[model samples]
Target: MKIKICFLLLLFAFSNSFGQQNNFNYKREIIGTNDQWHKLELPNEIFGKISPNLNDIRIIGISEQNDTLEAPYIIHSTEDQIKNVNVDFKLLNQSRDKNGYYFTFKVPTSNSINQIQLNFEQENFDWKTTLEGSQDQQNWYTLVEDYRILSINNAHTNYQFSKLNFPNANYGFYRIGIKSGEKPKLESAALFLKEIVKGKSRNYQIKKINTIENKKRKQTELDIDLGSPVLINNLKVNILESFDYYRPVHIQYVTDSTKTELGWKYNYQTLASGTLNSIEKNEFKFSNTVAQHVKIIIKNSDNEALTISNVEIGGSVYELLVRFSKPAKYFLYYGNTNARRPNYDISRFSDNIPKSITTLALGDEKIITKSETPKSEPLFADEKWLWAVMALIILILGGFTLKMIKKTDEREV
Candidate 1:
């Protein structure tokens, strides 16, 4: 019958374009902060007012503990915060090149240096450098233009480093640009005194494995599952070749309500052995708590058990404080994907949300301030009963096309 009247007018035009749209907006911007909330900027196009109503929206996420912060400049990392500063270097002249070798140093300072630490002992690979500074070495100042120097030996690990760090200076003449000619034997070129400190922001949110029901419990314990209960420091282990030598591993976790019956309650102990700087990052750093189950007891120190590669978990990151006020324009209105995380006291900012206090984007649903919110479901979710059931389905398809034109005028009488 005309394809059921064209499929009921295309299902009432796709339910009036997705269930009679009400209205909600999303385009957020207005992320500026510092004073140690750590630079997170956008600085333009500001608009926020909350009127699509519903008690003023509040569903935030990204470890949503509330107090709406935006970003910590997407987490900075050149991996630094070095401290081995003793200072004392004076080589002053050396040059050789076919691929590498150039030196001229003197880091005699009274204070005001970015940072430098080049304790060499080559032959392993990866090098690239160029560093310059001068208080009067005839006026020069480049200070690391593409710096990278690294060395590593196998059989489990051996190391050398020079990630060429820089950014701060008073200059007492410094210059070293060894583009890896592999003649590195220069031992002491240290001048460290740099500390950036901004820790509490961990990232690595999912990894759950609870399969091993038996097989002698997968032959001696191995469960780094973290599906919930997080706040960790570090643990990135993925070994194969049967866990490449060097043993002494005993780490355990799972204690929140302290579940028993052989489930969650591993007390808590940490100890890792071998290859720290000589690298193996079998990554181990602990003491943060709130776990979902992380136990890898490979004691008896070593041997054919720590095999089967895979065990990666990471967490512990903070500093996402967003409270900007100068020429504002902020946004981050979550999609209300179910919503549940509202303990807002603006998230107790231990003192530092005053860049002159000014914010407006109060939305995350459920902030109605009273009145209207009890239509009590049904009646076609009333919009005047959805236009009276679309006018009684167009008058029952126009009374069945006028009763088929009165049966063709009674068959032409």
Candidate 2:
């Protein structure tokens, strides 16, 4: 009884310590123009103000028919009469009972050229609209030619089309004639516009760029051109083997003082890939190789000089020296022949102290020899829960036998 009581207590203690608790928080930030919203941070805080001398105003990403824009920013025009207006939004509310949003703008003239760019993912059904140029808001023209699809990745898509172009006028008011049709389950969408000027320079530049996905369906596009491309001197390391098919979890490189790590550029195939460069105050060098850990550090970009170390790759028994990040231990192994079921399955083995650390002076097995110290799992496998249950049963049987003998003695007395 005492032994069982102690066993129950031990189990209870282990169970209590096994589970985990939660402590987490979240935040987001967004920045961009009215039509070209970029860097959308999550948990968007909506705004409700407009510029006074408004030439145009475009709103993006709304769900309902009304102007309930829960996005990060709000857009409105101050002028009594608005001209060119464009709204790129996904139809979040479906069915014929509801409408999307109405985009309003005032233009100086009628029958002017207008362009619309909408970024969105495709739905099961296709969405079509007619481009209409109007001054009195009654008669409309089908100016838009057709729709074209742009793929970013497997997950997203973009649609683009020319709205209307006026050969005579310098500016005009335009709106998309919403025909009665089935709306797509709304995804992310944005608007685009073009203004007419005689001698303005088209050399506008992008300050920052970020990618959402890495596929072809809706590949992220960033426009950047300030000056010449910044020169980031680098030593390129290519894993000839494709990562999609097989990934090497263990890679070590040596950088004492000469080399710098430009981080990994993952490729599904061929040479097309991205690049990660050294960050600040980091150096790399090649040196005496006796350590057992590898780290890939992205040095801050503001540094003058940085070094990278040995690069080693491991799959199984396949550790090959290439470069270094720091002191590291690497091991790889593979099968050789068709012998009796192999005793050492490299896949299932990891030594607390790496076997390479222990070397024989002549022919003497070191104190840390693998043959003497059995592999970790095997040493304790045979005597797991089964053996513990067996020991408990034996102890209980012995105690019962002792009790029976004491009872017999008492009855005789």
Candidate 3:
């Protein structure tokens, strides 16, 4: 691990050195106490008020004036770790007070130090901090001006060199002051910080906000371009499942079809008990009995784009005339086994073999009967009937002759 870290550092040094000018500048950071200063604990008070001692800074609570709201609480790290990191902060509001509850921390630093980077969670309130850098402890330069506001909870803020940089000298000292903007009534604010690397790290801050605001400026902004409205021709079918109309499909309709507007819709009332509807989307539910196929032509009156899903049908073809000012891709999903299906393999339908025919070894009766039939004999060539007729004539003639002979004998007697 040590070797790997060293290798990574070397790689970074080499790569960064080529493209960017290397500030071979490495300086010692100094941490001070009223009695004696420690090298590890720089910026004695982070955002002022709280002790530089890691333990004391961990748990600090601020009280507001005559408002009956709960106060914000802070928790610091244990002594054993220099990289003392705070994890969670819970703000409990009881009664409203004049000033909203908040906490502050003081950070000690070296006089030679230029800037500090702060990574924090909880962006509700404006975080304010002031820096005073000193060498002899007697004279100090107001290194950081005003307070910084960190907005958008679970985010980070970068304080620059100009605001937090100490005066030019060998030895330096600094202080960090913090305050929250919870109005007269005691609102609550909770936050925590993890120290990544303590050095002359550069900060990319929003140009509009001053370092004093302590309000964090983010590096990335979410820009949504809602596309044009699209017409949807969707059909739904219950395959291999016994379903009747009365199952409801929820359609989540949003004014702007973007990531932000993505939400859920339920069709509890529309779906009758014992009925199972497969259509699942936003909020509006469709009845299975009334409509098997539904066509929706969505036009965007709002300048934003529109998206649709959870189209329901009763396994039938629905003809839809879709008008689209913009290009859109339609996503259709079918439920196969109570599970979302796209499982229908196209290859399964490609076999042309008729259903009546079997590919297995089962003998085909139709083919066997046709092949086994013997050829019929011609009528003239059959001798059995002619022979039977000849025998019958002979017998009749013999009987007549015998009868006459008997009569002649009788006359002689």
Candidate 4:
């Protein structure tokens, strides 16, 4: 493996030396930290810049084309292993939702409940409810009221949600209510608090949010540009006013549509307004979905624009698989101006190919500990020195061109 890495490095160096004036520069990147070997797609731009006209290009650690020409992506010999996380959730309560199901659950005085899981079997209809906590069952106080639980299974939309989280409260008894539904079967559900051993890696953060506040006449609108398509998880809307109220926040992504009969069509999704009774922050969290541009229409409800301050949008952390034998120097490279994104499946293992792979029981899902954004490094392999050399060469060439042009002009005179 050492021999292969050295050979690939030499080949890449050779290509770089003879590359175009712009040159093909490789750089270090920190994309993800996963236990399995993540087969990644090289930045398409790399393919166009390198030895063009060739039938194929080589990536180290990836391709083993020829014994003489090794791939640039190959690692320095590493053992491959997988990290199995034992993830299992517990069942809370399973009952039919006929004419709105409401039940009282028990919570110990010591332990705090953070997550509420639900599994629905019925296909049609939307259910909304809330939770109330109290020391005694007779005297109850609303914890989170008018909360919605939707289970949609249709051609356009298909969703099965079983988890609802809230700020942990120390309460002896908790009430669960299901509103606006009759005879909704309980498929299977579990309430679990994730507990796992921490790994020695950082989280991967890949998002760039550009926020613009537009104070409308009776409402607040924001046209947010997320630099690129990202799987956004949530956004926090900052309301500066002291008064707390619930107003629906509508979100719509820039859909690819020329024009419809009624006019330009927009695919809009909405989050029901939550009860905001404090001066603190109120958050709107969405499921994992890819969106490049987002437009937010904040319902003012007579709430002035002066009350709004700012909004914060955050994307979900992405994980990639990498198989390393030992601690070796690795780099994350991307931004191939012109190249085809390679195709490879990371989930499939050559050895353990399940014959009947229809069923899969996944455990609790949590953020795998890994580095985010990447350590302070340039986008490409460190190539600032190459720029200096190119500048000097360009200066010499420019001077030579000037001398020739002067001779021609002097002859004409």
Candidate 5:
């Protein structure tokens, strides 16, 4: 019975240890009074410690009755709100003059539009364009003048910048003129009004940048360190060269590293990729990623390497929209690898949430140490049990020896 009890205790100890392994490692107090809902902006310091998907984040509240309650939350990333409206237009005329080519379009409802995207079948071209709007085709008013449209298609880079943006203009007729020696093959065009509502963002300071030119590979590589891991989505590369150039660039981040004989070898994953061109703003936006070390590779091919003047990295702020039931003290816990992402009804009904919410501040971070489990006593610790087992074995051997002696004596008689 004692041995059985000891075995059960050992099993219980192992189960408790496994449970504690999944417990949160860190927590912070949510400092605010009772409210229906509250917003909390996540601090940058916690990005490195928490899970990349933020699945382990939990808002736990303790009530006056000593009851623990979990508050459901939704992670929100502040980003641009864009609304686009496509305007219907019919091609009125397409003609070519000695200087260039012209295409005219007529809007039926005379809706206002501020942007036009032009697509072409040509592999490469560099041309200037002029846009004019008018209610009567005979009398045209110039809206945009001497705008450049560029496209480059080669072994190294494939890029195009053919979008025309201007102030909203309402007209019955719109005309586009391309300054080209030969006829231009126009594939399609789109006219639309784009409304964008920019959101708040925070810029991360880059601590150091190291540039290296790989002459053998014909590439320029930049190693960037942001001091600490941060959630970033946007990056801008400023070039110092004045001449026109287009190059394919790839952005990557370090995911892990290993120690080799010479130094630490890093494994990187691509975050974003696009063409770095002089015609457009060299800005690239991608999904939010948590990273500390980033690498940029520019394919220069046979051309001279372009000088980089500055690099800017930033992202939208992450906020938690939490709903509270009653007045209670709440704490945020995170840093658990075993935790899965939570699903709550509030996520489905996010539209019902109030537009305005009171933001709450967070207290100092505290480390949550796991509770120690009780140690079970050893099964063979008592000397009495060892002696008892030894005496029982001796008694069985002695009985067998006496029975064999009696059998031998009976056979001799």
Candidate 6:
């Protein structure tokens, strides 16, 4: 009897584990050729259904023999790829003129350079700059004119935009003119060729926007709602005013929500924080985040609030690089709460991935029906059978307890 009870308990636990492992809420067929490797871009609809970490996603392939196999995949996000090549240069001279300050750099290789990054010791300064390039110091051609470089260092914000970007120009010597009242303290400078590979992205529509100004806190808050939860990583806050202004901006997204008698309460987590200035584009990027509601808080301090024209939010599209062993029909399954992150060899050796592969499309999503029966039926196939098993176990335990009590009563008498 003891062995039977222990066996029943173990069976119950095993059944639960089996169900959790195989149960997935939704699936979509992969509409592509049975290539050795394929890439599938995840649609926006899956963002709301899958886990935030995306551990629940799986690719199941059915072979011609009707055997199911799990395929390993790597999630790839289309984020901007940047490559920079530093050009060795020497500072030929630094002088102050009636205009302001000027610095000359001589490049030995005379490589084609597009960007110059400057570092300064002074914390707070706004300066306009002009860049000129020439093979000889005497003959100079203007590269960038009247470009603004700004830095604001205070208790509330630390921001700088001192990088000068221009078209690729090859010259033996380069001179920079800074327009400032006093001699600007120069720290360091770097000349490099920057190559940016823009990634594929999708912009999300903002369903609603609400603004609130808090005079007491000296802050302006904007509440933005994207109708449904989607993956986002980029935001652009457009300011309408042309006047120069700088403010520290805090970005957050709703993680969870609760409903109460008052209203719906939202819990938010920080996504990114940066300074918003008139000199730069005011665009911010962070890790891909799944959110439906976002909040932006701007620290105005004593400065007047700037008018917001509009806000743009977007994220890089996610793709799955999957390897298929044999020609098989595959289906993408997700929405399993108890799923664990899979470890595969391809994840460790990502360099083996092909440079180019066919991108597969997804078919219409279908919900997995719970009423579908498995190939092999269990002892407790129905709810009534499970209840009956539980009742039998209880009766056997009760009988043993009564027997023990009766034996003890007889001995006492």
Give all TM-scores, in the order shown.
Answer: 0.35, 0.20, 0.17, 0.37, 0.84, 0.85
lDDT to native, each model: 0.51, 0.28, 0.28, 0.48, 0.87, 0.87
Query: Candidate 3: where are CA atoms >4 Å away?
Result: 1-111, 154-171, 181-413
Instruction: Say which prediction, candidate 1 or candidate 4, comes out ahead on TM-score.
Output: 4
- Candidate 2 lDDT: 0.28
Tens digit per residue, CA lDDT, model 4, 48-140: 233322223322222122112111222111112233322243334534455477655665534556666777667765667677777777899
CA-RMSD of model 6: 6.0
Once fitted onto the true fold, the runs of candidate 6 whose alpha carbons sit more than 4 angstroms away are 1-17, 154-157, 372-413
Better of 1 and 6 by lDDT: 6
Say what the RMSD of model 2 is: 26.7
Q: Model 6, range 108-193, lDDT digits (tens) per residue? A: 99579999999999999989999999997899999999999988887777888999999999999999999999788889999999
lDDT of candidate 3 over 1-413, digit per residue (tens): 44446555855664443222111111121111111101122221121221112122110111122211111112211121224233332222232233333222223332223344444444344445565544555776665555443333232222121122233322333434554454322233312233334222111111121111112321111111112222221233222333211222222223222234466432212222121222221223222212111222222222122222232322111111111122222111111122211122322543432223211111111111211111122321244543464466546655766777789799999
Q: Alpha-carbon error at 195 in model 3, in Å?
A: 19
Model 4 poorest 10 in a row by lDDT: 70-79
lDDT at 58 for candidate 5?
A: 88
Model 5 bad stretches (over 4 Å): 1-22, 372-413
Q: Put down candidate 1 lDDT per residue, 164-264, tens digits, no spaces.
A: 56787667778887776457777766676575664435455456554232344233456666655555656766666632244445567754346778876
- Order candidates by TM-score, high to low: 6, 5, 4, 1, 2, 3
Name the best candidate (by lDDT): 6
TM-score of 2: 0.20
Which window of 10 residues has the lowest lDDT sum in candidate 5?
Answer: 372-381
